[model samples]
Target: MLRLGNPGRRISVGLIGMTFVLSIFAGRLIQLQGLDSKVYTAKAAEQRVRPEKLPARRGAITDADGHELALTLEAREIFIDPSVVSAAKRDQVATALAAELGVQKEPIMAKLAAGGRYQQVAAAVDPTVAQRIMDRDFKGVGSKHRYRRDYPGGDLAGTLLGFVGSDGTGLSGLESTYNKLLAGRDGEQFVETGLEGQRIPMTGGTLKAPVDGGSVRLTVNRDIQWAAQKAIADQVKAVGARTGSAIVMDVQTGHLLAMANAPELDLKNWQKAPPEDWVNRSVTDVFEPGSTNKVITAAAALESGAVRPESVFSVRDNIRCADQVLRDSHPHPMERLTFSGVVATSSNVGTILAAQKVGDEKLYGMLQRFGFGVKPGSGLPGEEAGLLPDWRNWSGSQRCTVAYGQGVSVTALQTASVYQTIANGGTRVTPRIVAGTTNGEGVFTPSAPGARTRVIGERTAKEIAGMLEAAVSTDGTGNLAAIDGYRVAGKTGTAMRYDTRCQGYCGYTSTFVGFAPADKPRLVVLAVVQDPQKGHYGGEIAAPVFKKVMTFALKSKKIPPTGTRPPAVRIRAGE
Candidate 1:
């Protein structure tokens, strides 16, 4: 009954409603196309494009012989977008991936079940394994390019070469010292991608090329280093020593031929090695120089005109300095001995008496000039400056103890440099291990040789060399250090290992330092064995090590023996 009003009125009402609906649709179109177009377009583009990192390849490290110590190889990192994988296919996908990656299924399953958009399944996987997984074309699994460090030499020179971290950063040794030079700048790349995160072929993208790192060339001679390492390691084990170190250097140039340490770390698996095995003990550890330090006192005495090599001394087994008593390594009768004889025999009592004539200032000055109490400037990290109290702080006992290498400490490298100075004719040159660096462009930049400072007169150096020569002859304390067909000159030392807990001596550190072809010294080798249980004397434990290393070094350098006989000198208690 209510529908009877009119068809004309109904048609008018319909037209008005239609007009209002059209207007609303038109207004929304204008707002979307004009007012907010940029915001919507930017969001759409962001979803389509993703930026990825372009990793840079790290540099290589080589020895003087161009043998590879460390380098980087191409590796793959596998990732998964768990959100794209279905629960029904999860177990099958994880099994296949685990088989290809050589990993357990549990870890892969855990990552698949993480319920996240992205997860890393494996890192630093071999390229072949990654390729196998990619060949399968799994629903959510893929791999990206990466770099991993490789040490081909295993544990050889491991401490010196150091290792890299999981993030591809250098962690120690030369790797850490020159990290900036070795780690080049990383670049970037942008790629258009689909909704499922797969790269779209022919989609527009941008890229910035990466710069590869520069290579480092060291002065180490691998052959000589191998020989030295073998010699020291065998000797240390034979003597039942805690640890040992040996250094061979070119006397004239201060280039370290070889710096070998025992208890080395395996560079490939350094993470499993103890922290102590990764230390370069030659530069980091310090101990008293023992009788080997008497050379410094002799140089001081001769330079100060307090005594000559021919000067006579009335010696005794022990001498009193303040309340403390200083004694030689062994007891001897009262006798008259020349200065040269005292040094050849390593007479601690005679050295203290001679040191008294020069006093503390002159002796301390000589020690500083010899590169003790300071880092050798080898550019190695964590180098310690051994303890050398100022002469002004020297107590009566300190002065006498220091005269024969007590109350002071020095590193193995510093101890080697002392003899290198005399062998290089009294000029102390800074030791260098890195020969130079090479850039990506193949341009080499040589490292500057260390500055040489004259520590004593040339004549004084020769006189000391001659006295050292006598010490290695049949008559003296270092006779075991003599090499056939080579006039070797060196000093033997056995110092008490200072224990902080006891605040006194607990063990002995035996050392032998010397050079071969004495008159024209070319190589200076120093061997130090700490806490030897079987034998404690330097002549017994350390001297033979020195001889073995020096012999190999001399032969490796192809230096012909001087073939000259050692000069005649008297080393008896009375001369």
Candidate 2:
């Protein structure tokens, strides 16, 4: 430099050095102010505060008797912060977590080494295990408050209560239907963290508390439901059927006392069940009601002044309509059957003739009034409206077939409602599952009561119910449905399942729809066996099942017998 051999080189070197220094300063400023601001701010806040989550408690579900069917309890989701996990101790931490969570060690190690600051290793951990993990004082492992819906009754009301998903969402039954009311809001707080990545002792921001969901009280009688389920399951197993469903309703109040299904699954493990087992067939599936639909036909005839209980119809051996010839199960060559006998015998020819007399328009109108082809407005989720052909499109044989429940399709709930109308003295009432709502003060306020519409005169319902009683009498077709002390008015249905090869109907859907305590009816029950073994008949299969369920239901409700005993008569062999 002293010699100054190259003055130009010296000046250029000086300029380059100055530019490099300026660039370094600018880059540092940009990174510190822009790129790292969020991290720095979070670190600073972490040093001064600690925040927490406030989880809303899910509402409980109770039966009519105040028995807890479903409830929510505190649960925890175990999580970890890899940023706080010591590199030297990573293997130990992963191994411990994997062992505790019943998972493989390699997976846990991979998750921990993934380099994320926070991760959920496991959720819904057992309280004791969560406590152990918390006690370990590991900076990475922690837990948060969550809700786990528990059914103390287990599979008892699983089908009705439904199960919750991993995200705490309801997926079926009442849980799915009332999710909005059941799933309360979630609240969170902002907290400070320390240099070691531990939550600080102070809260930095405002606090917001979660609002709890309202409790739901249902009208389902737990005891009766238990009994009904047991009976239905037993019958389903005994009959070697694919599946079965039963519904017990309060005829007067339109309250569903009990809903039962066979091949029941535990709500906690609903995911493991078969697809068919999860279906609530009582309201979802529709089948040709077979002779059980004759009740509607008879009601229409009786209500429209088309026929009387004492009125007689000469049922021929066969009545041809269009390409089809309708015949009774048993051949009758122009027999004199009283209006009551027509139903008691479950004669297809007689029912068709009676429906013709009632006319298609009037019959269709009555069907609509009775809640057929339309949704029952039961508030149950995924309820099918069922299929009812319009009057204009109905074929000549279609009308007759529908009259005896061959062409038309209906759910068990729809069938039960028909009986419910008869039991309620011909007034149609909407059915309800929820009993009431709890107020802010925890006082239960009854829900808006169901509305009843007069479908037919009281005298008509009584007359029809009387004739129905004769159908289940000792000499009636549904003799197997008779309960010793209770007067049951019911009909048997055995329609073949639809098959393409048989030209139309093939397999059978056996069913029975009936009410008990005929004098002062208290309960209406509908039972159906989807596809049974060879001896598939409603009177043979479904009737006995109804008798069992009805007997239990009456005894459970303590419904006193209202009338003197009819002299004991032997049930006929063929009946």
Best by TM-score: 1
TM-scores for all predictions:
0.95, 0.88
Weakest ten-residue segment in model 2 by summed lDDT: 566-575
Please give, for residues 474-510, the per-residue lDDT of candidate 1 as tens digits: 7789999998888889999989998676788988999
lDDT for position 257 in model 1:
88
Q: What is the C-alpha RMSD of each candidate to the true structure, in Å?
A: 2.1, 5.2
User: What global local distance difference test value does model 1 have?
Assistant: 0.90
User: Using alpha carbons, what is the TM-score of model 1?
Assistant: 0.95
Clash-forming residue pairs, model 2: 46-192, 46-193, 47-193, 49-192, 50-192, 50-202, 51-191, 496-507, 497-507, 497-508
